[model samples]
Target: MKKAKTISLNVGIALALFAVFLVPAASATTVSIGSTIVGEGETGVVSLMVNDVTDLGGVHVNLTYDASVVNVTALTNSDFDSKPNLYKRGHGWVLLEGGQYESGLSGSVKLCDVTLEAVGKAGESSYLNLTDIDIETFTYPPTDIPIDEVINGTFTIKPVTPSAKVVINEFEQNPPGDDSGNEWIELYNNDSTSVNIGGWKLINSGGKVVTIPDDTVIAVHGYWVANWTNGSLEDSNEYITLYNATGTEIDNTLTAADGNNDERCWARYPNGIDTDSDNDWKYQTSTMGETNGVPVAPVDTTPPTTNVTAPPTLWPGKPDETTIPSGTPLPWTSEPVQLWFFRTDNSDSGTGVAYTNLSLASESVADLVNVTISNNTWTWETNLSKGKNTTVPGTVGEYFNVTISEECNATIEYYSVDKNETPRVEPKKNLTVRIRFEIPFSEVTPGTRYTANVTHDLIEPANEGKDATIVFFAETATIDSKPYYVLDINKSVGGTEMYVGINETAENFTMKRLVMKNKTGKIMDLTFNPEYTMLNYPLWVGKTWTSTINVSGTVTYANNTTIPINIITTEIEAKVTGEENLTTPYGELRCLVVETNAGILDTGLSKPITITAKYWISADEKAMIPKYQSYINGNLTEELVLK
Candidate 1:
């Protein structure tokens, strides 16, 4: 049986050895934990002591504190050092330096809180221990407390501009901008409240005043009223003066009416005190309204739009006569000019129309413009740049957006259309059309199947104030086809020559003769010279050598005997045996003796005879397969036979 260890709560704590004074009524005792404050680069001292304990035997105690929960800074003096050894123990902490103890006396341990000169790593917490180590019956509080939450406060701010002014002067225009037929005024909201500028009037030197409605509220700490009339008259260069609801002059531009300089100001009441000024905006060296005497930005102000009608200069018919105002300018060019072609047709199926206005190199057409067609469910714009080569997702029959943009002129034209089938451009008739290409493949591989689909549509564009075009889909005629394989080999030995059968086959079930070439640059058989069939031939697979030979050149056999084969029609591979640069040919090249019923040298044999000889290979064949012979068109072209 294991004996329980005794815990050291208080050195003098003992279980009533003499029964002092009637055992003072067994009352509950409580313990409390506290922390000490340490300055920057300073140390903190802590103590753990126990009192009023009746018994302290048969208890094992340990204290643990997480150092990370508390900040431990470098001490100013070397004397102040925090070695975890002094207090930290196995999952707990212990008090160090127990001085002389007195019977029934209070016991205390000292600890030093480190001073932090600089901020330590963020998102960390340190802890202290006040827990009971071995006494399970004596409950103790936890020591791990969040230290990161006990940090200091911080402050931050946004940026501001210089030359932005705050003043009170007369104004010719609400916002000061270009005076040449264009006018604008800027206001900065320096406060943190949304200010109401309703009933505020923009007064001019000529006594003309424009009222700002109640909706004229500027956002807090931002610019507002970039231009007068909610910025509509921004382009109109007119002198402006500002007035409050009481018709009093609160702010105005200088007499010069140059619409420049720091002569602009904003006031609370008409002529009331200015709460904030461009020259006094807080938290910045410069102002928020101006940057180097130039306007930084227009206020986030929204102005009403006005429609102005202008007469057309020239027209096809009605020359010197007035026509309807529905037609837009002719030759729309890069702008999003409305296009409408109407023809009285009672037919249910609309006319087929095809028109090419831009090429693949053109910019996006539907960027800023929208087209709508009446009685049509789709709109379309074709502005695909070959450089982008964008691909649309979904099947060819799905609905998609077609956009065209003209970079030369800042304009974008777009439409939406559903293309379920191909669209045709027919004879003379009014029809709406939309086209977008939907390629099924992201990229084209050599022998991979891919479909390039062109979606088409026709619709009306004048009914719904939007561009609408129907869509139809069609795909290319041919998909992907396999590559053709041909094996050409030629070889000559001394004066005798033998030609391997040539074979060329296509994946489309077409077959032809495989061509032959030699070292002497001769099309047929010539002098036997090596080095013509190097890497150009496929001889090695992976790092290993497969039996593949090319009959392009001549091969010298033993006894001065040689055979020239034009093409070796054999399914063999040239593979690398070892790192010694030796190529070994392996596989069956000829029919079995029983299958042929004649001999391996049968002249009319479909399978070629397998020959092995080093000198019988082409010169280029050695360099081609670094470790093996040549394997071309999935067939053996050359083989080296051992003498």
Candidate 2:
């Protein structure tokens, strides 16, 4: 029985040993490095992570990469409690090992982080490969932990491209007179930032290459011209190509016939426009250093014809009458008097009237006018024939005394009559008046037709009978398939006459162009692309709109200095602020207040400028006028107010 029992115990122990051997070990761990992208010359970090680790007490990792693409900059152990026991780096590989001093770590953890710098050219890539990795568990005798997966990372270098765009703008393959010494190519920088084009090459189809000189730079929205005196361009079928400093093709023109000396050349219509197709090039009049467009012939010199069509010989209380009689005297009233004139320029299929200017010549009384003053107010009363006098009563101690007298003309004087009072006069309040009586008329220029509507108030109430004559010129034009009556107002400032062109439409009013002519005959024409909108129809408060304006043209100064104005894009935001009664030179009328803010991208300036303009628009009169304008640039401010 004892032998049998001992044999049974041995069998039980054998079964127990088999059961211990059947137990499963821990799960496999995973080591990996994630992929990353970095720009050339930029730095990036890659983490060496471990997952599903069990009793991980020590670790050894080795990584390799393409040295030409990226270089390891730093290596730091993260998961271990103590510093790495061994850390080393070579040309293309790195090795690190570390261990925990107190207890073994379980579960997932970060082993190390490797920082690298992208050193290769754009589009190059490198591999982060792991090799010779070992992980051990904390025990009396350390045991190796099995790795089920190894994830490698990839590092890529991305290209860096400039934001400024440059393109071939215009070219003249054939000269109007001679081919040699005239063949030229033009390049334009279309962005607001300047670009360096040094070492750029221009290649013709005939194997001729013109290399741009060193240090060549193009300004913002500016041009660079290359003249080939040797006639490198072919007059027949040919194309030109542009290459940057690194031999990369930047732009190319389509294969087409040359200008053939037709006084025209290939140019981008809006200037600096390039779609890499034929639609961008146009064969038109050569605007070498100006905006591209068809050339305009000289304007006809014939003056328009004008005729008075309002005011009848019979005195009527109505102000809008077209006729009274042939020679009736104007009524003596404080109400505004209306003057109307019909103008036409149909002769010779005339180029519409350009502008109109109406002048208030003189107000004359047929009999002597006497003035009487009372309580700081004055009145005119006729006494003697062919003589006039005006007076303004002064406050005893505050205001200066104003007086005027004339036999047939008027002379004004200011003085103080009270000895105890020191007369005070405002700067703009001191007035001088000189009047001539005879009707004077002179024809300054010839025209075809003219039409105008003017209203004036004769408030002086001098002699009862007064005669006044109105003189003006009017013109018309068609723009963008729309009929526009062009009214030009020339404001002279510092030897420069600024012509503001207002194009009135039935629905709204806009400004089409601005011409600044100096006394030296040099002119600068600034055209608003898409016509700047001054007012919009259905005017109401809180109405808002936005527009983008491109201003382009040429400027010539009085000193003969010329500047080619490249395309300047401005963003405009407009809103109807409110409505108010506006008092203008014409009269007091209800007007809608429109405020506009314009952000202009000015070339050669570090930042964009802002121009704020406020306008008063009379819906009933169909008049839009600027009330105030302010411009703010870097360190500069300008403000203008209409008086």
The TM-score values for the models, in the order shown, are 0.18, 0.26
Tens-digit lDDT track for model 1 on 1-643?
Answer: 1222234423235544445655666443223234554433334544333323322221222233333234333212211122222332221123222211122112121222223221212333233433322211212231221111111111111122323332332122323444433344445544456667778777555565557777687666445543343333321333456677777765654333232333343222222124444332211122223431323442322211111121233233544323224213232222232333222111234221111111122343322323322113323332333222222211111222232232222222211111112332112111112222111111112222211111111111122122211111111111123223222221231111221111222111111122223332323232111111111122211222222233333332323334555543232222222222233342222110000000123243334444331222122211221111223223343332211
Over 4 Å off in model 2, which ranges? 1-28, 162-643
RMSD of 2: 41.5
Model 1 misplacement above 4 A:
1-160, 167-202, 208-239, 242-498, 503-643
Task: Tell how far residue 369 is off in model 2, in angstroms.
Answer: 99
- Looking at model 1, which ten-residue stretch has the lowest summed lDDT? 590-599
The candidate scoring highest on TM-score is: 2
Give the distance in Å from residue 47's predicted Cα in candidate 2 to where it truly belongs.
1.5
